[model samples]
Target: MQYRMLSDQRKRWVDCLRGFCMMAILLFHTEIYYTGTSIIGYNLYVSDALYLFFMLSGYLLYKKAGMIDIKYKLKSVLRNLLWPYFIFTSVMAVPKALAHGERVDNAWALVQNVVTGQASWFIAALIVAEIFFVVALRLCRGNLFALGSVCVLSFCCSALLALNGNLVTFWQFGNALQAMLFLFLGYVFHRYEHKLVVDVWPTV
Candidate 1:
């Protein structure tokens, strides 16, 4: 009974954290849209909230990471992320194009944009990152060293891409690479949360 109460308290705190991050992101975007600059001038800090959001997502899904069926995971990703991305992108394409005074002449262009995550790039990047994380988990098979190595490699690649200004916008592969780091961090945190807390503060 005590364990159950602690679990519920943890969940409540997690939800609160998520809500705070969401509000921060919304405010950041709102300021950008209206002011053309971060009036508060804390752009980087607020932007980091998105990574935190990714971490939370990975933390929540940590239990499922142990599943052996890669195909099942991929299918879930497609159904949850890819389908919504395509449907919403398709629906909004015409209006978005018109708003920018762009001609919607090429159906292929629209299709390409959707495929490349031109509509909601976050979702697209998430799809890629989640797939990579899942595959890496399967290969690592609970080996922290292997997983850490993969995360380091991903971070380096993403940093290089950013430095070279080679980030594929809309496709957001670079963003996903960095996002993987946070996701992995979240997974590891969940896996060792109690030990970490104890190490940080011996007395709870």
Candidate 2:
């Protein structure tokens, strides 16, 4: 059997980081709604765990793309993410619309909710980010710098658009852009793991 030192180390480190993020998410959700305040600064960290989770996802998927069929991966994502999103959101929207005296069979209304992210918005943003990343990877031929530039431009666009939240549907697109940025950062971290050392310190 052959052993790879850096690969093993990176895998263990990423796993541990994910475990920590899971715990943080658990704690954040448990307390955030009821307490309405910070828990020893965990509040500050809570918002970041989601971004880190998305980043880790991108890092892993980018590596897998090089090893597997991209078309199959894209189809799997579409089936798993978008399909469920549409079904569940439509199911919820129709009843809610009835209760509110809105038209019961409004396809445009359903699509607007889906696009404006009235459903599971996070999942919608994630689906868009994943699809965008996968397509961009194929076009860029896995060029990290080119992809990174795209992510940077996305961030700039998000910032500029967010400033006019009244006009643009900034929240949805801003979140998607930020998700892409974090995903790209995760890919960068994985690709350069050999040169990076992550350190942790006890909070005293």
The TM-score leader among the candidates is 1
Candidate 1: worst-modelled 10 consecutive residues by lDDT:
195-204
Local accuracy of candidate 2 as per-residue lDDT tens digits, 83-108: 88878887788766765467867788
lDDT of 1: 0.79
Q: How close is candidate 1 to the true structure, as a TM-score?
A: 0.81
Model 2's alpha-carbon lDDT is 0.71
Residue 152 Cα positional deviation in candidate 2, in Å, after optimal superposition: 0.5
Candidate 1 per-residue lDDT over residues 118-170, each given as its tens digit: 77777788888888888888889868789878987998899998899887575
Q: List the residue pairs that clash in candidate 1.
A: none
User: How well does each candidate superpose onto the true structure, as a TM-score?
Assistant: 0.81, 0.68
Each candidate's lDDT (Cα)? 0.79, 0.71
Off by over 4 Å in 1: 64-68, 94-110, 196-204
Q: What TM-score does prediction 2 earn?
A: 0.68
